[model samples]
Target: MKPIMKISPCILLLLSSFASLTSALTLTVGDKTSVCAATSLIVDGVLDYYQGTTYGGTIGLFKDPYYWWEAGEAFGGMIDNWYFCENDTYEDLIYSALMNQRGSDKDYIPSNQSLTEGNDDQSFWGFAVLEAMERNFTNPPSDQPGWLALAQAVYNTIWARWDTANCGGGLRWQIFTWNKGYDYKNTISNASLFFIASRLARYTSNDTYAQTAEEVYDWLTETSGFVVSSNDTTNAYTVYDGAGISGNCSDLSTGEWTYNYGILMAGCAYMYNHTSDTKWETELEKYVNGISIFYNTSNNNIIYERQCQQSGSCTNDQRSFKSIFSRCLGQTAILAPQHQSDIMKVIEASAAGAAQSCSGGSDGHTCGLNWGYGGWDGWYGLGEQISALEIIQNTLVLQYDAPLTNETGGTSEGDTEAGLDTNDVTNVNEITVSQKDKVSAAIVTTVTLVTFLGLSVWMVL
Candidate 1:
């Protein structure tokens, strides 16, 4: 009879930990698979086509037959999907679009013509590249420029063009003076800057980025009066559209856009992560509550832009707003896990509605602009596809417990630990031995056992 080998308590704990770690990477079965399928349909059917010119190495924008700015927005959405899905199939396409859209110095100038390309357009692409670097979708190359370096170059150009004389200290909507929207100092550009600065601060551990983020937030809320509390019963603090050049940067436009609030929420969340300041947390809560109050519909609880309520029609730009908002809200959830439940409630409802509305299309998965309504709104564009992809990706990340950075110094199956090196035993010892640590230790043991078994066979020879 074979004798049973006794397993130590330590070994049992380690094995348990290993099991948890392994399960974390495995995709959840039902909704995630459907979401991924929808994403593939959008990428293959809608976004892949060749235009007049190619820049980096591949064909034209992955999102074919769209405006330059919309192309940039779509590129961002696709990059986000790539990050969440952990695939690089779209990398060359993204690289080519970014290259074609860039200026001589990588300034992200989609077009040289005035009013066509603006700070917001450049910032969107820059934000996407920055996200790619943060998520490890792209890494910094030693021999050449990387995503981080390119993003910094774009930020430098934007800093050089900051309009201190006009709106105290904010970016103009357009880069050129002759452009049509040049006089409009919009919330999107400034909030994008704040988001970029906050992320750079976290990535590089630089206080200057934190300071810049704070400055942008202060200028928008205190100086420009773009941030206001809604007079309705919700009374949540909301970010409005920017003041025009005519008002001397005093009068704020009542136009409320989701991306403006979303960017600022993400910026605050990152600032909180970097500084551990409660002020940013307070701001985050305000934004989350504001989004809940204003964007969420009573009947379906799906997100919607208030300005488009009169007509079920949303502009090309507004079509992608909720996706951006969901992505940013997901970031906030990672930063403050306390808010994860609230954020998830909002995201899951929208994703469910989005998935349900994915019928009657030629592909049978083309989503619509209004997620609150039942049926497809007969609108099938790159923007709608991107929005659906974003919500789905955000839901996947949240449901799987995949935070971008592990704050607890614990082992996550598919996530990187933020504060400790996985290879260093000393750092591992410094961390408290939670269930996750036990699992991480089990991983270390498994590798060691493989090495020992290999050596033992060699010795037998």
Candidate 2:
């Protein structure tokens, strides 16, 4: 038998509030009843943050500190729960939230969010619909655009905004010029496009979508030098944060986030699943190898945000990242089965850790942020709850069929140009920031923010 590790006074306090049988989540993998109970409990915890509960703000959007984009992810999480656990408890709310935010053009870009929303923001809502389309979830009425069409519209808009001139090619983080990070190109934005395109490729069987996914992958790794500077035969490429175009994209912000790595691995899995080609398989191996950096090996292989969790500085937006990462990692396990054992091991461990963290708050079930700490870390939010829910329910992934394709029982319909007017929604091209204007700001801004470019700048997003 292994000896017990002695706990410190501080650590004991952190774990004390959760010392209860009533509220702490508990789970065992491959047990459908256990998984559903855990997901149902945690799913309700996630919805507890919805502003709809208070009737103060919009019905679909979550309460503040949580932004509009993460709400999209929240609904996406519900879709996953419904599919895997066969739980329809939150379906109507999820559908209402999705439709309300879909902009006038029927894209995910709600007009109310136009001022602050960026490419990544819009793509997340698209990711929700993409999830809906791929899983053959309940579709909207005929008068409303189908899930596939809504997702396609978002894909088309972000694809149109792919800037070839600066940083060689990649989508900007912010959609509008006036936004703080407009000059920055981040992995989440580009990786999101890769995700939508790859899934679309599988759903549509269109070579164009696959080609688009490949191009974005190339730019992320090669041209932008943001993911990898060269094809490292080691397959140990570190996915960095982002880079500014002012220095011709030479100044790299090396802060790493879990979702950045997770999204790419997921897209690669989708591509491999579609083609059964070894190249995409190779790509998956590279990224899956790279995924180790996010895990806390000493703590039962629990996953945490490497950059910010330790520092206790993860912003409201950053807090929600693990939810996305865990969701995608689940996708990777489903689409690329070769990696299933390894991925599920981490997910299982993290889910147990997450279950421990959820034993805090008055409800005694509100989740804390860090899962590797053995118990609550005192940090709590919608991000924590959502993160816990995704990892826990994804244990049910193998019990269901892999995400559906158009020819493989998917019933969603599509429209090629469904959201073509998204540019008008974002108002990006309405006024251009000239090169001289861009370079002038980048010179001073880069020098001023050199030390904390990726570190602190994430707060604005």
Q: RMSDs, each prediction?
A: 20.8, 7.5
For model 2 the TM-score comes to: 0.88
| lDDT values, one for every candidate | 0.64, 0.82
- After superposing candidate 2 on the true structure, give the runs of residues whose Cα lies further than 4 Å from its correct spot: 1-21, 229-234, 422-461
Writing each residue's lDDT as its tens digit, candidate 2 over 188-251 gives 9999999999999999999999999999999988888788723566666688889888987889
> Candidate 1 overall Cα lDDT vs. reference?
0.64
- On lDDT, the leading prediction is 2
lDDT of 1 at 393: 71
Clashing pairs in 1: 17-439, 47-62
Highest TM-score among the candidates is held by which one?
2
Candidate 2 residue 169 Cα shift, in angstroms, is 1.4
